[model samples]
Every structure is written in C-alpha cells, then in structure tokens.
Target: MAVSDQIVRWRYRLVPDHLLGEILTKRWVDNAIPVLILIVVAAVFGWLIPDFFSAAGISSLMRQWGEFTLIALALMIVMVAGGIDLSVGSTFALGNIVALTLITVAGWPVPAVIGATLACGALVGLVNGVLVGYLRLRAFLTTLVTLIIVRAIVDMMLLKYSVAIAAGFVDSDLWYYFGEGDVLGVPFSVATALVLALVAHLVLSRSRVGWHVLAVGGSRRSAHNVGIPVRRVICLTYVVSGTLAALSGVLFASRLGGAGADTGVGLEIAALTAAVLGGNSLGGGRGSAAKAIIGAIIVMIMVNGLVRIGVTRGGSSLLLGMVLLAAVAIDVRWLKNRHKFLSKVYVSPTYSELPEAPATSGSSPYALNDRLRPVEAIGLGQIDGPEDVILDEDDHIYVGNRTGDIVRFFAPDYTRQEVFVHVGGRPLGMAFAKDGALLVCIGGMGLYSIGRDRSIRKLTDETNRSWLSVIDDSRLRLADDLDIAPDGRVFFSEATVRYEMHEWPVDCLESRGNGRIICYDPNTGTTRTVIKNLLFPNGICMMHDGQSFLFAETWACRVSRYWFDGPKKGTVEVVIGDLPGYPDNINRASDGTYWLALVGVRTPSLDLALKMPGFRRRMARRIAPDEWLYPNINTGCVVRFDETGRIIETLWDFGGENHPMITSMREHKGHLYIGGILNNRVGRLKLDGMDPTWSGIDSYWRRT
Candidate 1:
C-alpha cells in the first residue's frame, strides 16, 4: 500500500470522524446549550458567593430548588398542553394561607389541612379548565383574569387575618418535622420533589395520558381529528398544574410557619422562565421532567444567589427578566432552525481512497454476455423486492420480501406461494440451520430465525459496544447478509452502522469504512464484532472447508477471505480487488466455484467522486437528496469465479430483460435462482452443463 493510502486508512479507523455529526443527532443534544448556560451561571455565582457549593449552601439551595421545581413542573405541564397558568402564583398564596389558617388557628390535623389546601387548588383549576377547554376561551386572557380575581380575593382575606395568622403557631411534632426535616441528609421537600418528578416523567413519556397531552399540545385541531380528546386533555393538564403548584405551597407553608402578602408574588413569571430555559418547548408537545428540574435550579439559584450577595431585590428582578428574555429568544430560534443546522453539519464525510477500476472489456475475463436474457421469470409481478433467494431441502423456493416476510413459492411449478413467516422488518440474505431453522438477516433489526414450528426467535440484536463511540454501534442497524459456518456460530455482514437499510445510498455517498463483520455463537449465546472499518460489507459465504469464509465489501468493489481456523486464523486476506461493479452475496456453484452478485456497475463519475471527499461533502450539503449523484445500481451482471479468485464466466442481462441489479444468486439443480432488491420477481436460468441433482443443503453439512 502507498504511504498516503495507508495513513488515510488508519486515521479514519482509529479516530472516528463521524462522532461530531452523530453527537448532534442524539436527543440529549437539545439540552447542550441550556446545560452550558447552567454551568456558566453556577460558576459565576459560586465565585461571587463564599461557600456556594458547601454542604450548608447545597442544603439551602435544595430546599428552595425543590419547592420551585414542583411549581416549574406544574407550569411546564400546562405549557406542554398548549396553555399557560398565570393564576398559579395567586392560587399558591391562597393554598399557603388556607393551609396555615387550618393548621395553626382551626387546630385541624395535618392530613385535613393538606386535603383542604389541595381542594382550594382544584377549585381554581376547575374554573380555568371549563373556560379554556370547553368554552374555547383564549388561555392567556382567561388565566390572567383568574390571576387578578384570585389575587384580589387573597388580598381581602389577608387584610382581615394577617395579624392573627402571625400570632398563631402549630404545636404538632409531625408538622415541624415535615417543615424542617431531612431524610438521610436530604431535605424532605427535595426528596418528595424527586419522587414526584419521577412519576410525572413516566406519565408524560410512557403513558397514553402523556401521549394525549403532547398530541393535544402539538395541534388541538389535528389532535381532535385523530380522536385524541383535546378538550379533555387540556382540562387534565390544568388540574395537574394546579394540584402540583398548591402542593408546593403546602411545603412552603410548612417551612415558613405562616403566609404573607409576598408569599407567592411573581412566582408564575419565575416558573415560566425556568420552563423555557430548561429546554422545555414553549410551543408545547416537547417537554420532559428533567427539563423542568434543570430550569428550576437555574431560576431558584439566580434569585437566591443574588439575595445572598446583598444585591437589591429590584436589581435582581431586572437581571432575571433579562435572563428570561434570552431564554425565550433561544427557544424561538433554536426550534425554528435546528433541522436546518443539522442538515448542513450532520451529513459529515471522511477522506477515502479507492483502487483504480479495471478489467470489464470484452477481451477481458469479465466480458458480459446475454445469458440472463432467456431467463424464465418466476412469481412474476407477485412478490416484492426479493433481495436473496434460497432453496430448502424440499426444493421449496424461499425469497425475502421487503414487506418483512419470507415469501415461499412451492417447488416444481413455482406457482403457489405463501408468507412463511412475518418478522416485521426488511428481511435480506437467508440460510438454513442444521436443525431446519431458517436464519434471516433483518435490516434495521438484527439476525433472527424461524424454527420448524414456524416460531420466530431473535438470535441477536446487539454486539459488544465500541468504546468512545458517540452513537451506540452495539445495536444492529443494518444486518445485510449472513452465512453459517461448520460450528454453530453465524457470521453476518453489517453493511453500515451509520446509515439504515433504506438509506444505503447515503453510505455510498460518504464512502467511508462504516461497516463491519459480526459473529454470533449460539453455543454461548454471545455476539461480538470480529472485523471493523469495512466499506459496506454486504455478503457472507462460509467456505467449502468451513475453516474460513468469503465476504464482499460492496463500496470497495472487492471480495475478501476471513479464516476462523488453521494457520491463517484471526486474519483477513483480499481475494479480488479490481471488480468493475459492486459485489453483493456470494454462494457456492455446483462445480466448486463461486457465484458473485454485482448489484451495481461502477461509473467513471462515481469512482472520481469517491476520491474527491471535499466535493462529495459539499454536494451532500448543497444539493437535494434526489439530485445528488449516486453510483449506477440500476443494472449489473453476475460473475462466476473459481476458488483461487480467477474469473470463470459472466452472466448478463444488458437491458435487464428479466432481472436487473442482481443482489444474490443461488445455483440449484443445474439452475441459478436470481434475485434483485429493486426487481419485483425472481429469475430462474437453466445451465447446460452443470450438476442437475446437486443440492445447496448437501454442499456443506453433508460432508460434516
């Protein structure tokens, strides 16, 4: 190998250039900016305030953070439901006063005080729900009206009872314990908040109620069209919001021992700031419990930290207002242009070098002829995208269909067919196990099997994960082809971990070594990656000796041998390097030769583009996907080669008369069964001078 080619090879293999784009694609990347902002704010405050991260400081922050978190979560729920709760601050004051009066003055038990306070919140929520949900009143105006009415009522009551409330005190030990208690060094309010946050997260993310809330929030009209009960969902959201906000008030009252005029003033505004700043979407449909918690910490710390530093209340409020404006600005722009930014940066390309194309002339051994022109089409216009075909012991014709089924055409006539099994993923290459089980490669899923009873079993869905990989490569994304060795272990080709089966063309555009070979041993029920940094490894065929295997790297236009036993064990050697077309599945020919499927023919344009990584990168970012240049996969031929990697014969259908883009070919009973991923039917071509009685099943297992 040349110095430049070898350097490029190891550079990409050792250090994955694809990590940056992949990291950006992850769900948590949405919180990147907010997390950074939180870090910067905390650092600045920690520096300004002495012992800001000390035990006492953290304990103090937790008490206030926990209380504020519940209020933020409450507002987040309403905001997620496409509504706002301006009355939350007023309702909170009412709950605080109601709880305090009942406990200290009326001498009510703790449980009764809690119940009455919750009821007060529920009543307020009911009014909002009915007006906004059922009456179709504008949420902002309705909630603002509720805020004023509720605040006015609280003020009138406070004027009459403020002096008496401050003089009263609860003598109950449980009340004091809950108010100022710590469980295992963590404050009771913080512990309770954590528990409630967990429950809310599960409900919003995992339950039907949560899905309904998001659906309604996304679009009320669309949600109602889909029978999602938009009005009911809206009502449920407000009730949850009010109850949680009131619950926070109970905790606040417990700690403070009384309520005042400024008990919950400007709280709704603070909660709203926390919601959007925590990465929760203001447009609804996109929020999480974690986001609420994050927002709460930022808002609570900023306020408390300011007070601790002796910053005046007005100056602190102004700073908070500025922060809220910045948060809203981020929320608006980030939501609008996220995908646009991803489009430009996410389709990252890496440098790759390809060997010069060779030997496709008529005078060369790869000369194309019209052998497939007279090929008899089987199951014409019946099946869909049969990527690979195989014949069982009974000569039953099995072809993998794109509709997640293995369609089998009965033997002899090949007229009758049925869905042998529905695995519910795009099935590709297939092989029969020793126990008559049908092993299949399910694209985007993993390797699966169908036993004699037609029961489906998952062989493996994941391998040992690669360390430092941003994307989880352990989970199988595209299991393209497979073949069983002499041992119970199954070897398979993962075409590309970067792109899915449907996005196979994109993998070609990058043309990077994003593929690998995997081995699954049923004996120990263990799966692991055996080879890495391959260019779209597509085909696997266990050699006749069972000591090694033959695999194809599709984009590299090459075939390679992997030895699992003997002197060459644990090593790979290239068998053919200069094929003019992209090679796919390889199967044994009756006369001790191999049949290789050239799924696509190489063009000079694409071969040039492969070397010009910069050009391909810009093309991907600038051009529409359909307009982007792709290798010619529309037409290709089948090549027959000997054991020593020497070409024997070539089969062609120049105009694709019967089958185009041959992905796999199985030679059985002197006839070759041709399958194409883009073609609708399987083609059967008779061979003049081949073994008529030879069977694919008897080839490898019978010798053992």
Candidate 2:
C-alpha cells in the first residue's frame, strides 16, 4: 500500500469512524454546540479585554442575562408545542405596570402585587390561547394582534400613572430589596431564573404534559388522532409562556424600582433568536429550557463583547442580526437533511474474507431442495411482510405482518383469514403465553400482549439507556423477536439500539454491537436488560427443557444460547456460527429439536463488501438507498437442529418462486407451517413420519 493509503487506514482505525458518527448524530450534542461556541467566543473576548472575566464583569453579564433567559425559556415552551407567542414583550410590559402600580399607587402588600401581576399575565395568555386554539386562528397572526393590542393598552396606562408609581416606589425598602437583592452571592434575579429553568426542564422532560406537548408539536393531526386534547395542550403552552414572561417583567421592574413603556421592547426578537439558536425547532416538537439559557448566554456574550470593543449601537445590532440569520439558516438545513447527513457519516464494519460456499443448486448439505411444498395464499394481497408465524390450540395459524397487524387463518385447510388485532407498529415475533395471551414484539413500540378478546396491552417500552450512547436508548428501537420462558419471564431481542426500525440495513452496514437482549418479569412487573452489545439479535426461542433459550444474531449470522436456570444461568455461548445466510425466527420442532429460518442466503458480493469497510461507507453515502446492495433476502431455507445444535435437515424453496423469503416455521400435526416476509402467503409441507393428530400446543402443554 502507498504511504498515503497507510496513513488513511491508520487514521480510520485510530478514530473508528462510528465514534464521529455517534457524536454528530446525537441530539444533546446538537443542543450543546451553541453553548460550546459561546464559550469559545467568550474566551476570545476575555483575551482581547483583560477585565472581561473579572468578578464585576461576570456579575453584570449574569444580571443582564437573567430576564432574557426567562423570556427565552417561555418562548421555548410555546415553540416546542408548535406555536409562537409574539405578544410576550407586550405581556411583560403589562406585568411590570401591574406590579408597580399595585405596590406604589395602591400601597398594596407585596404578595397582592405579585398575584395581580401574574393574574394579568395569565389573562393575556388565555385570550391568545382562545384565539389560536379554539378559533383556529394562526398562532403567529393571533399573537401578533395580541401584541399590538396589549402594547397599546400598556402605553395608555403608563401615560396616565407612570409618574405616580415612580415617585411612590423610589425609596421603598421592599422595592430596594427586590430590585437589588443577593442570595448566597448570587443575584436574586439570576437565582430565580435558574430555579425556574430547572423546574421547566423537569416539567418538559419528565411529565405527561411534556409528552403531549411534544406529540402535538411533532404532528397535530396525528396527535389528535391518538386521542390527545390538542387544543388544551396548545392553550396550556401559551399560558406557560405568558406566565413566565410576566414573571420576568416583574423581576425587571422590581430590580429597577420602576416601570416603563420601552422596558421590554425588542424582547420578543431576542427571545425567539435565543431559543432558535439553542436548538429549539421553529417547526416545533424539539427543545429544552437548558438550551434556551445557553442560547441567551451566547447572545449576551456577543452583544456585551461588541459593546466593550466600542462598537456603535447600530453596528452591534447589525452583527447580532447577521448572527441570528446565520444560525436560523443552519438550523433549518440541519433539520431537513439530518438523516441524510447521518447516513453519509456512518461507518461500515470491516469483515474478514468469507469462506466460499456452494451454489444454490449444488449438491452440498446446505444446497436448496424441493422440501417446502406450496400452500394456499393466506391474506394474499392483504398482508405485506408476514415475518413470523405461530399456531394456536386449534391449529389456527397467526402471522405478524408489515402493516402492524396480526392476521389469523383458521384451521381445517387454512383458507379464511381475519385480523386478530392491530398493534400500531410493525409486529415481528410472537408467542403464546401460558395464560392464553399472545405476546408480541413490536418493531419500534416495544413488548406487548394481546388478550383472548384481542385487546392490546403494552408490557414494556424502555430499558435503562446507556450513558455511553449518543442517542436515547431508553425506548426500544427494534423489538424484533421474543419468546416466553417457563417462569413467565419474557425474553426479547432489540435489534440495533442506534437505528430506527426502517434503518435495519444501516445497522447491518455498521456491524457494530448495538443490539441487546431484554427480559420482562411478569411476577415483579419489571423489565431489565439481560445482555448488552449484541449484533442485531433477531429471533428467540426457549429450549424444551426450560433452562435456556436460543437467539439469532442476524448481522453476525450466528445463534447463541442464553441460560436462565441451572448452573449455566446468566451465561451466553454460541450454539451455531458462520451460517451461510442471515437467520430470522426460530421455533421448536415436534421431535424435541428446533427449526431455524434463514431469511437470506449470503453471497460472495455481500461478503466482499463487508470485508471492505471503506468501500461500504462510501457506498452508503454516495449511492441512493434503492441502488445500494442489501441483504440477499430474496432466497432462504429452513434448517432443523438437534439438541446439540448440529444441523439435522435443510429444507429449501429451490428457485424462491413458491416462497421468496422464509422467515419462520412451526411443525404441527404432521405438517410444517412456513411464513415468508415478502411472500403473499404462508406455506405448508407434510412431514412423512410425523403423527397427524399432534398439535403444537398439545406437544408443548399436554405433558403426558
């Protein structure tokens, strides 16, 4: 290799391409970048102006940023709920007027003044909310009108009472303390802002209201369809925005011991700019209070630094405008092309050279054959991607389809089909619980169960998210397959924590350890991670002895045994490795053996691509998705294995014409029932020596 090539290879190895991808793709990093940039700019300014980092300088910066940060957080809530409050500045002015007038002109107690101020703010928000939420007015237009009307009202009030309130409160001790008080060496206003920010963050991230707000912001129509009270949520967000703005106004007036018409002028623009710069999406559904504070700090640093450098006010305004415009442009572009950018940055795995395999028609032990006989199409054109199959007590076949449904075909020739239940996520693997409920692993939703009446219930949707992960790994991204152990503990496979269900191919390309095995205990109502850092763990099946279960790691083309009881409990060992295809669902055979389905037969081209990480990464970026080479999912076979994990028999659809991609198979009543993800039907093949009267349910639960 050339010296340049060697250097490039070393660089790729040392840094490990996936590390960069994780960092760039993380949401928190996106939110934190503005803060990092602010720090760098502050450092530069400190270098230029030796006093910039002094205690006095820092205190001044904090005092200035306190109210701005509060307003920015208020805007963040509204923006996160897919709305905007253009009237916040006017509301702030109104609040300031209300608090000061009540305290000085009326000689009211401090608590009454504060109450009146907040009440006035809530009333303003209510009006705006009613206009936008109930009247269906555009949020921007409705808030703009509110802004104009409120500003007019505040101006008239100030013109009438501004002089009286200013004189009355000039030497008041209460006003003095509120205006310039310090707590534990921190400015009162700054401390109050920090507390509010912390509370807001908790409400947004940990509460059900926050979830609803995010849902409404993400997609209003969808949120409404899911039974969320969209109008109520929107209204509440505006109320929060208005109340926070009002609080900030009160703080401003108390600190200055006065109120004025221009006190909150231009605050709306500053808050909006700061919120957006902090990573609050103008389009909604994403943001945090912490991010809003960080954005406020960034804006303050730039503005203060420019003033210290003796820039004219107009020039500083121009610079701020330019920065806001640039930040907005960058944010918009990133939101639009985030997925594409992630695809480009993703690093593919490096694989060793694969051993050569025989052709599909070759006379090797793994060669294709005509053992899988064709059967009638079950839900022919109705079901897409019937990935797994199971049988009930009556020999009725149940299969999970691509469209997030479980379709059932009645026994006695298996012709009539009905929708067993709608799961709302791509249903992949399923098993019958001892209580007659159907346990299912939904692709993106999590583990769920369907009762006998077909009512759906969620079991678990999250695990302990790893701190090392760049993305939120709490929610299961791909609950691909699962099986129920004898003790009522549900074991499932989460295929690739880093990618969504639709991005399974990306997980394959990365070939990194991003998958995990999770177990949910019904007795304790707790779910926990059993194993972490597996490579695309797909299908799972409990052993007949109830001591261990076998699960397929699709990307690695291996099956592993996980023991839940006996001396080998909590240990994992490879049962079978280096198969010639990617395995899918595994089920028990009638004769105390197991049946494993290979979804796709591996090919030389794919093997070569896996070995060349650099080539794969480039292909992922440069090639369109449809043009990129995927797994050989067009042809597959079913192979049976003994208790010792040795292949007993291999069955195939020779040309993949009858069944294109076999994913799951179960033996019942002298017949081997088959399912294919891409095929329009389920298949059935007769076992020459099996008993005709033995059903799968009977074999498992009958027990002599």
Candidate 3:
C-alpha cells in the first residue's frame, strides 16, 4: 500500500470514483471558471447600475479599457515565456512622448513617426532582453531598473519641453479615426486591440516561437538540452512586450490629444493584475493572450463597478490590489498541489476476486520441483535490485541495479565485478542490438542505448498523452521492458502512464489500462505507439518465429502475443490467462521454450478487493499505507512454457530465502541465470543434460 492509496480509502466514500473522474477529466472547465466569475460579477453590477448594459455605457467602458488591455497583453507575453516586465508603463509614457515630439515638433509624417516610436520602444525592450536573457539577470530586477530609468528620462524631457500635439495634427482625420472614430459600430481603439489580441493568440498557441517560449518557460534546462534557443526566445519575449506597450502608449496619446508625464502611470500594476487574473502563472510556462483579454475585462469591470458604487479612486485602487494578491496566492498553491488534488478526483480501475490458484499437488503438472541447485552467489552484497540480467558474446554477465548502475561480471570464473555504466534511472529490461549496442528501458527515463565505447544516448521518451491526463504524460513514466525484432526495430512497454515505476503496486490496486506498447526504429529515429491502454504491460520478448512477440500484462494475469509480420500482423491474441501469479519477465529457454518469472502469487483477499471498485476506492482513501492490502510480492515461482502456452516445469523458492521476488530468468550454456528485484545476489542453476559451451546470443542469431 502507498500513501496515495491510503488517502483514497480514508477520505472518499459518498462520491463514486467514476463521477469524480468525469469531473476532474474536464480540464477546460477549470479554465472556464474565471469567465464564469466575470459573468456573475457583470450580472450583479448590471442589476445594481441600471445603465451598465446601455450602449453609451458599454462604449465608454471599451474606450477606457482599450489601452490597459493592450498593456496587459504585453505583460502576458513576457509572463507566458516565464518572465515579467515592470517597465511597460514607463515605456508606454515614453512612446506617447516620442510620437508627440516627432509628429508635432519635428513635423514628421504620421506614418514615419509611428514607425520610429515603435522602433524606439523595441530598442528599449532589446536592452531588457539582453540583460535578462544574455546576461542572465533576474527578470524582476532588470525590468524594475528599466522602469525607473525610462520614467526618469521622460521626466527630464518633459521638464525641458512642453507636451503638446501640433494644431494641424490635432484635427487630422487619421488621428481622429484612431482616437474616437467607430468601425462597424465598434470603437476603432477597441477593434484594433481585438485584432492584435487575435493575432497574439495564434502566435502564442500555434507558432514555433511561441512553442519555444513555452518550453523555455516550462523548464529552461530541458529547453536548452532539447536544442531550443532559450536565451533568444527569452529575449524575443521582452522585445514583444516593449513593442506592445509602446503601441498602447500611442493609442492613449491619440485619444487624449497630447502626451503627459503621468499619461501611463499606474498602468503596469493594472496590466499585471489583469494578466494574473486571466490565469497566467508568475512562474511562467503556462497561459494565453486570449485569457489575458478576459482578465483585463474583469479588472476593468471591478474598477468601473467601484466607481459606479461611489467609491473613491484611492479606495478602488486598494480593492484591486487586494484582488491581485488573492489571485497570486491561489495560483501558487494550486500549482504546487495539483497532482494530489487530481489523484483524489479520478477513478482507478476495479478488480474482481482473485481466481483460484492452479493445483500444485506433488504429481500435478503445476507442482514446483526443486531442480535448481544454486552453484554460487555472484555480486553478493555488491548490487541492489538486479531486476533483469543479460550476457554478451564474450560471456560477461550484466545486470541493471537499483543504484542506476549496469554492473558487469567477468567471464569464466565470474568472480570479478565492475560497473559497466550508469544510466541515472532504474534500468529494467535489456537486449543486445544487431550492431552490438545495449538497448535498455529505464524505469522513468524511457528507452536508451549504449554503444561499445560505453557512450549512452537517448532514443525516445515521449508519446502522445491523452487529453484527460492530469499530468504531462508525454515522457515515458515507467518503461519496463523491451525486445528487438529481426528488422532492427526495438519494441518496449511503458508499464503505467498514470504512475511512476516505484508506485507499480498502486497501479495494481487501480488495475486500470494505463500501460502501452511502443516501437522505435534506430535507423530512422522514429518512435510510435503499437498498442495502448493496457493493464500493466510488462515483460516483452520477440518470438522464435520472428513475426510476433509475447508480452505479459501483470495485473491481468495474462500473456498476449502481438504480430508485426505474416498473416497475423497488427493483431493481438491472448496466449494464456488467469495465472496463479503476476508475471514480471519472459525470456527464451534453451529447449525451444520460454521461462516466465512470477513476482507475486495472487491471494483470495487481494482478488476479492479487485472485484469491488467502490470498496477499493474507499480503502485507498482511508487505510494507512502499512495497513492496506498490497499484492503478495513476497513469494514467487518461475515456470517454463512451451510454444502452445502449456506449463512444462515449475521452479519455486517457497521460503524466498535464496531468491525472493524473481523478476527475470535467462537460460544459456546449460545454466539458468536468475535475477530478483529484492535479492542481494544473482542465482545460477545447472541443467542436467545441456551443452556447456552454448551461449544465448548464438542460439538466437544462428542461421536457419
């Protein structure tokens, strides 16, 4: 039992798991709550202020919100890229001053003046970008300094020159159109903001630059490792922020007919509040421009409503500050505990009662015989959790251990032991490629290969995650086992997308189809899913026929065959089902048969719990981890199966003193090599009548 299981059993009873899962699966509903809140607020205000819904009132609201909305959009971009800009308000004021001076005093054409104003704003943003991106300065401090510097410069310029537009331009048609004209019954300023918002939404959600921005914001180190230009993306975000702020300034100056020192004062806080309210994270990597627009509307409504209720300007400002503070606090807490919240609200699969175990009478076919006479203990007290074992051409034995190291034992006497390589994750299933490289499935890191020179490289770690997934399921969570086909293709199993490798038992309790099978081609660098939504698809091994493979679904207690060639290609069929134990690994035996390692034998209580989804859900919530009923992994047995899936011979360590939790067994050169996940040493058993010189590699690759 795990803590998650305990919480599930203790806390929930009345709410069915299926209904809870349905509610939690609707992620879009969470995002829509802000909009719903805004609607409710608007409805309340409209009732209170009879003129709130009138055309005149609506037009006034749009004009007042237009510039702030633009500024909010600017801040939203930086925030989405995992940064922030506090200088937007100052940049806005400066853009207005630049436009006023260039158009009225310099007597420049309106088009050139506008372009120059935007360029200057971009230049300011470029400086911020270089400092924050290239120099690695903190976004908050860098933007704060820029804000002070730009405001100071504007103050000095205002002291020396009057802030006024020329009389000729004040009455200009273009100026009037931007400032107060209407387009299709919508204010030109509002319409322009809407157009920019639409474009920003598309660029943020659909463009490469936007993707890079999000990636960097999500995890800067991961983005850099994946070859994304992290610094450049961060720099571009600041530049975009500056340009948008400048555009807002120009719009405000046009509407007011002149530039003022306080033209954009206090706008930065407003924009930030709006962006945060719209669901933008202060920590970055999540959010949208469209949401920012909605957030801006919410802020504007709050301000307008306060004024309508006869509150003082200062009092309204205080209320807005309080709102921003509350939103930030909620967002931070939510992000930190999102996983815990989701686990409680989702339905896990239910299991039926465990079927009766096969008869194990002394003369029965399923009877366990002690034919395995242990020869010697190899790597004793040196390795931890050698879940799987393999041998090379030179007869060197290799095992992946719990400490994330692949340990190798020298050939012949098999006494000398040394680490071959470190994979930085729990390494499980392994196979030798045709090119002699070692292909391994790392528990949490996905598929990887190590060359002869011991250099490790990642093959793939991503799959198409389901929309209903509560976490980012793109990365393989638990790549349990793998096998290679004759066509040089590597196939592997992701045990459970819903849980990490260590939490495998919890997955058993859920028994949901969260596992998947995937194939990767080394030559073309492509990885794709073969079969999805499986019940803990664990061990995988290519068939002797070379047209199909066998994989065990641990929770389902069944071995299934998947074909990739011949008539049965692209199909799956059950070879065996309703086993007495949960299977872990399947390996080829020397006598044209297969060895299956049962990590745990099923119990009646565990089986009964599986059948009752409601009871299991309650138990998962209420029971303490140490007190809850977990799968019986303490006792296990290995059985040999022929091509027809009929049991041939069974070997058992009933007391589990020699080999507890046998996860894998491989036959080679007249010997059976055994590996256990919880044992300290590897076990080797001698076969009575087999050639002593045979090797596993030679047996599999021999010419037809």
My TM-score estimates for the predictions, one after another, are 0.94, 0.83, 0.75
lDDT of 3 by residue, 1-704 (tens): 55755554444333334455545555454467579868987998989999887998888889878878889999999998889999999999998888777767777777887799899889889999999999999999999999999999888866655534535355367865776887898888788889999998888789888899889989999999999999999999889889988888777777776766777787888889899888888888888877788889999998898898999989988988998898898778877877676666554555444446676666866676555435357888988999999998887899998999999999877889989999999989999887788999999899999999999999999876667655556789999999998888899999987777878888887886778999898788888888987889989988899999999999888888999889989999888776888998998887778889999888878887776677777776676546767889977688889767898888877666677678988877888888888877788888776667776677666622
lDDT of 1 by residue, 445-536 (tens): 99999998899999999999999777789999999999999887999999988888889989988887789999999999999999998999
RMSD, one per candidate, in order = 2.5, 4.5, 6.6
Off by over 4 Å in 1: 1-17, 54-56, 206-208, 215-229
Which window of 10 residues has the lowest lDDT sum in candidate 1?
A: 8-17
- Spell out the clash pairs found in candidate 2: 179-255
Tens digits of per-residue lDDT for model 2, 249-349: 88888877677768777778877888888888888898888889889988888778899999997898777777778888988898899877877886556
Instruction: Please count the clashing residue pairs in each candidate, in the order shown.
Output: 0, 1, 17
lDDT of 1: 0.87
lDDT of 3 at 639: 85
Comparing 1 and 2 on lDDT, the stronger one = 1
The lDDT values for all models are 0.87, 0.83, 0.83
Query: What lDDT would candidate 3 get against the real structure?
Result: 0.83
In model 3, the runs with Cα more than 4 Å from the true position are 1-32, 35-66, 74-247, 259-269, 282-290, 297-329, 332-339, 346-349, 359-375, 452-459, 463-475, 521-526, 568-571, 622-628, 690-693
Candidates 2 and 3, the one with greater TM-score: 2
